[model samples]
Target: MDATLWKNSSFLKLWLAQLTANIGDQCYSFALLWYLLQATKSGTALSLLAIPEMAAGLMFYLTGGVLADRYSPRLLMAGTDAARIVVVISVGVMASFGVGQFGFFLAAQFLLGVFSSLFQPARTVALKSILPLELLGRANGILDTTFRSIRILAPMTIGLLAGSVPLSALFFANAASYLVSVFFVLTIRDSLKGKGGSTASKLTLGQYKRDIATGASELRHTRDLFYILLFGNLGYLVWLVTYNVGFPFLAERMDQGNGSTLAMLMGFYGIGNLLGSLYMARACYTRHLLVVLIGWMMQAAGFLLLTGGPAFHWLAFLGAALAGVGGPLIGIPSVTAIQVKATDANVGKVYAINMLMYTCCGMLSSCLGALWLGKLPVERLFLVSGLALVLLTVVGLAVEKRNHTTKHHSLDL
Candidate 1:
């Protein structure tokens, strides 16, 4: 519970590794997008880049989860980090030779996605293994804050670099960052159980199936955790729809609908997110349901304000900030709940499934928003999704309360 979580050398090393890798990935992503736009001048080019990446990630997540549970996360993570370094460096080499084709970039993106899927489950398990139970919440808060902070700055930083540095240099820089992360990962000594047991035997298909089943069984047994995850994923879907699709459309419709205004909106949201992350790192909230409920409501308010309705158009920035603040309120507690409830044996699967659901939600939002954006006004979408989120949050809280009371009454009887 001490706020000085960095005192733990293992956690510090893991955090640094993750930080470096995240920044590098962001830069790589920005560079890829920029290159695609300049080369193709078609929206389909972006889709071609994103869809394959998403598909690769989705296809590998469950397998990654199983591997995370079956093997040493430290080794798995390091290996994947090394693999990505090779992939990125290869791409950089190709770029240096004037081979910046869409197909080449797509291949690199897909490889990165595959490696990322493998890395994520392992990273989650590794973090849990290194950090104590009491510090999970704080560590998660700090990590989330760090990621958000990077997101806020990475685009701008990369944009500045895009003007001065070649895409090949950016790719090489990303590879170098991953190489640094590999060093940090190798330095950490994981005290996780069953470290060397993974290499002892060949895994049969039946065994792999059984491992995945056990993970699913673990979730099925934890009823509260399951419901929380369900609501959390759905909430994420709604948030994604509003933010990704609705925000840009609304911004364009607003007066002075320029890049600067849109950037200001995002900047405000990032500041709020940064503050929220810092707040959660320092303070502990015992009631997760209340936290989630408050977060959803705040998020809903933000979305509604973003609707750009009469007399409320100027308050859109405030809405963005509220949404940012509300996000960590839900995310940190939800992750803590899962980590606390899951056994080490099933933790990897739980985290994997959790990530898969979140990713799928984003995909669903993107697809559905695309379909709806053409037929309806963007403000209506924002308002509806916001209200729906509010309703879902209320329902989730009520269900949890009833379950709590029912269990208590049955115990009394």
Candidate 2:
């Protein structure tokens, strides 16, 4: 990791922008989700909120990839933020004016999702350009940790203002954050935005198809990235989806619907995640997959402990913290590998492919989480999650061993 990472002004600007934006996003989500649950009195509505976003990612990720690779990432990022501001403001206006329709909210979610899909690829491209490859892991760590922290603090802060503040306030705050984000993004030097892969006239139908094919080929040939994207992330999916949907239920069952307990568990998880990300930022490694598998194993053990958590409060906090620590272990290395290994020309497209995988799996996991929560006990769900991680870890270890052996034999020859 670069010791001067803290001194890098361009990266700092980007980091600050991301920090403010994520905090706003957290606030908006907390406010809107509460509204939905109150309006519909259905967990299904909460689940439904994620659907349109995933739908947009599925539909637009490829196109977003093409554009990011073919244009100025700086412009794309700023433009996306500008568009988000409008969408968020629109949502607030509708709510303030007494609009009660759920579909209207879903439509707003879909539009925001579109910008998210675009911004994600562009953001990666921008990051790769901002700093050298050596600092990439630490940068990713900074962003991930900030996001996790906001996930913990933002909701609680909103809860504190429940009666004093209006829900529309969250929406407007989110828009303002985006407005600030756009300003920071534009302030970045123009020379830093890497040139696009194709000219406007060259991006014809046949060329677009070829560009997509090229990115797919690049990803298929990248062994580490392919494995992490497919299997390692699958394990992470188990941890993220199950825990998110299960936490409130655990709180309900264990404490007789106490919100404080839920908040406490989340705090432990967030703190652990912060520490793990800091570790990844300072630590160095060439075998990214090993770090990811180790993370999964740690989380698996945490989940196993969590099966006994509801019965014992100490175990619950300990388990949540351990699981939280595993997240950055899996995430930072995977992202760094892409930033370092993927060809510069294809980096955006490759990242888009990665995000697309997340979108598809996210939708599946959301449904499975809802189904499992309805049918299985919370203890059993934690057990299943833990066991699933154990399975993924075993498979990943086997693959790593085989790859190492193959490389050694070829060297000997």
> Which candidate comes out best when scored by TM-score?
1
Give stretches of model 2 more than 4 Å off: 1-3, 37-42, 191-193, 196-201, 408-413
lDDT (10s digit) by residue, model 1, range 1-413: 46468888888999899899889988888876776687778888887777777888788888888888778888888999999999988877876776657888888888888988998888777878887787888888888888988988898888888888788788888888899899999888764555544563566899888888998899999887787677777887778767877777777776446766677777888898898888887767555666767778888888888776324666788888888898888788778777777888887788778878888988988878777876888778878988998898889889878867887899999
Model 2: weakest 10-residue lDDT segment is 191-200
Q: What's the distance in Å from true for residue 119, model 1?
A: 0.9
- Number of colliding residue pairs in each model: 0, 0
Residue 390's C-alpha lDDT in candidate 2? 95
Best by lDDT: 2
